[model samples]
Target: MTYVAVALLLGLVILVHELGHFLAAKAVGLPVVRFSLGLGPVLWSRTWGGTRCCLSAVPFGGYVLLALAGEKDYLAAPLWRRIAFSLAGPVANLLFALCCYAAVYAVSPGEHSLAGYCVKPLAWTLGTAQAMLAAIPRLFGHAQELSSLVGIVAEGGRFVGASASRLLMLGGYISVSLAVFNLLPLPPLDGGKIVCDILVRCRAGLARYYVPVSACGWLALIALMLYATIQDVCRYLA
Candidate 1:
């Protein structure tokens, strides 16, 4: 049950982001050849007005493939329109996070609003969400807990309950975080695109290497961090 909730939450936010892209592309006369939810092969799809929108097999994330969005077609379009399309995805994510925060806040105890770091998720969220779901098994007379305490992480603790003001604050913080994460100046990612754009206009020699170098560098750092974490885990377990 806990896993299901987590997946659904992630899927919904991602889908809304894709929808934002789709809508913006259509509005700007940029054909969206394929708008897909999830990562792999199609589970289900429907074509409308020269667009093929699909739900894919992967549950991780979704994409809106704006037709020729990276090519001359997009470049030929009005600059404002192109910028709007680029911004739509993250805007949708913020809105989705807000809606989720509002619903959760309304159902809980104190004051709540969509102004803060709701989606950032601290370490306690998993366990809290898990424990809450485990209690539901009682309706079926099951004695075992459905989800167990995982670990403590930032943005997950003390997030549950009745405060609307705090909930909204969390939501806003997470939305800003998502925006900033995408804005990061790096390749195969949104931030990378911006850097590439700059390199193109400035005739920089590093244009081709911008994405690859940053990506590889980050990957190496992340791998080292993971290795260190595994060593720590093994030590603790031993």
Candidate 2:
């Protein structure tokens, strides 16, 4: 049951991230092709307004596809608008973390001094995010202090068994971690998109290279996930 709760919590966190992109696109009048929850074969779908919203069979991750002609076509929008759209996803994750932390604090003020748990978490989260970003390069050189989805569920279930407050705190940490991960300047990630927009705004010749680089980045990300998953499986089996 605790693992089930963690799975549900993860779904909500993902929804929060995707909602940021969906709302931002609507606000800026960008054409959103599909807003999908999960990946693989479509489990269910419905068309609404200009977007086809659906749930896929696998619940690994969600994505928002744009109806633009190509990657660079997004540049047709104002730079600020593009940046906002790109940054919205990660920002939403950050906000979700804050809300989770705030909710937990509100429920049990006795667990922590008021000052220790409230706004300080927001500041601490930002600092933690920066530290995580600085550690990304270590993924190749050493075993990273990162968790795969399997690991998250395992740890989250243990926390849930301990106490509801612990589970909530874990959720908050996961939210912050997701936000920071999305901000990495790699392609197919929110941070990479943000950087691409910035380069375009700066009229840097390298702006054109963003898409190609991101393609490679996606492969690297997949490899990283696979490595992390193997580590998680080995630990679990042991």
Candidate 3:
């Protein structure tokens, strides 16, 4: 039961991430090609409101595919709108994290729960995020220390086994991590897209190199993921 709860919790996080993109695209009048719950083979699919939503075979991550209205139509939209679309995912994650923290801090079955809510959770999340950023130097300085999907599930399972409150707290921390990770200034990421868009606007020459840069970034990320996964498996075995 705890394991199932953890799996559902992780899926919810991915759903929330994609929801941000979907909502932002709709708000900006951008057409969506598809919204998938996972990556790989489509297990189940349906079309709604002109968008094809699918459940894919892989259960790790998900994405929202936006349709180009036209070569000129999409380009005609203001740059700010495009940036907002890219930023919505991370912003949503941050907001969800704040909500999770607030929920965890409030005592349930009591009258003062909502009234006693404060910004402490938000501040704590910020501090935790900063500490994570600071620890990046150590990843290169020492052995691989980051958790992969398996490790994440394992940690979530442990938390769920401990208590629901702990699971909520873990969910909040994971939300913060997701927001921070997506904001990294590497191609294909939200931060990367925003940075590249700005660069292209400032200097048209950079536009031609966007694909190549994004491809390289994708390869780098995949390699990092592979390394992390291997480390995670080894740690689990040990």
Candidate 4:
């Protein structure tokens, strides 16, 4: 039950993140091709309102695919629109975390006042976000501290147990983490893509390198995931 809860919690967070991208793309008049709720082979899919919605075999994370062909290519969009689309996912995760924290506070209001009811959640969410932002500089120096999907699920399940409140708290933390991580200025990440877009806009000559840079970024991300997974395995074994 704990494992199932953890998986569902992770899936919900990923879905919220992707939903933000999907909505932002639509808002910017960009057509969406697919919105998937997992990473691998599709278990089920349905097309609705011109977008293919999918549920895949894996439950780790998901993605939103935008239709970037013909006149509606992502590159052809205005810089602000592109940036907004890129930022929407992280913003959605943050909002989701805020809501989770709010729910937590609503359930267990330490203070009985109306001010406490409203301010506590906001304060908690902001504090967590601030701490996460501050920790970004130390991430590279502490590779072993990084947790892979497996490690996250395992540890989160243990921490959450069967308590709904604990589950909410854990989900909120993961959501905040997702928001922060996506904002890192590395290629293929949302922040990295935004940076690249800005650079290309400033110097159109650099447009040629975007694909290769994105490929390299993906490679690096995969390598990091593998390293984290190995670290998790070693830690568990010890």
Root-mean-square deviation per candidate: 11.4, 2.6, 2.4, 1.8
Ranking by lDDT: 4, 3, 2, 1
Top-TM-score candidate index: 4
Question: Candidate 4 — which pairs collide?
Answer: none
Tell me the spans in candidate 3 whose CA falls farther than 4 Å from its real position.
69-77, 108-115
lDDT of 2 by residue, 42-89 (tens): 999999997999999979689888899986687777887777788888
lDDT of 1 by residue, 43-118 (tens): 9999988888888897656788877744545445565666677777767665655565545555666755544335
Pairs of residues at least 3 apart in sequence or in different chains that clash in candidate 2: none
Error of 3 at 140 (Å): 3.1
User: How much lDDT does candidate 2 score?
Assistant: 0.82
What tens digits encode model 4's per-residue C-alpha lDDT throughout 74-171? 67789998899999999999899988887887787466667775687778778888999998888889877789988988999999988888999988
Report every candidate's CA lDDT.
0.57, 0.82, 0.82, 0.88
- Model 4 residue 225 distance off true place after TM-score fit, in angstroms: 0.5
Off by over 4 Å in 4: 70-72
Write down the lDDT that model 3 would get. 0.82
Candidate 1 residue 38 Cα shift, in angstroms, is 0.8
Query: Of 1 and 3, which scores higher on TM-score?
Result: 3
| Candidate 1 segments exceeding 4 Å error | 108-177, 198-238
**Model 3 TM-score?**
0.91
Select the stronger candidate by lDDT from 3 and 4: 4
Model 1 residue 100 CA deviation (Å) reads 3.0
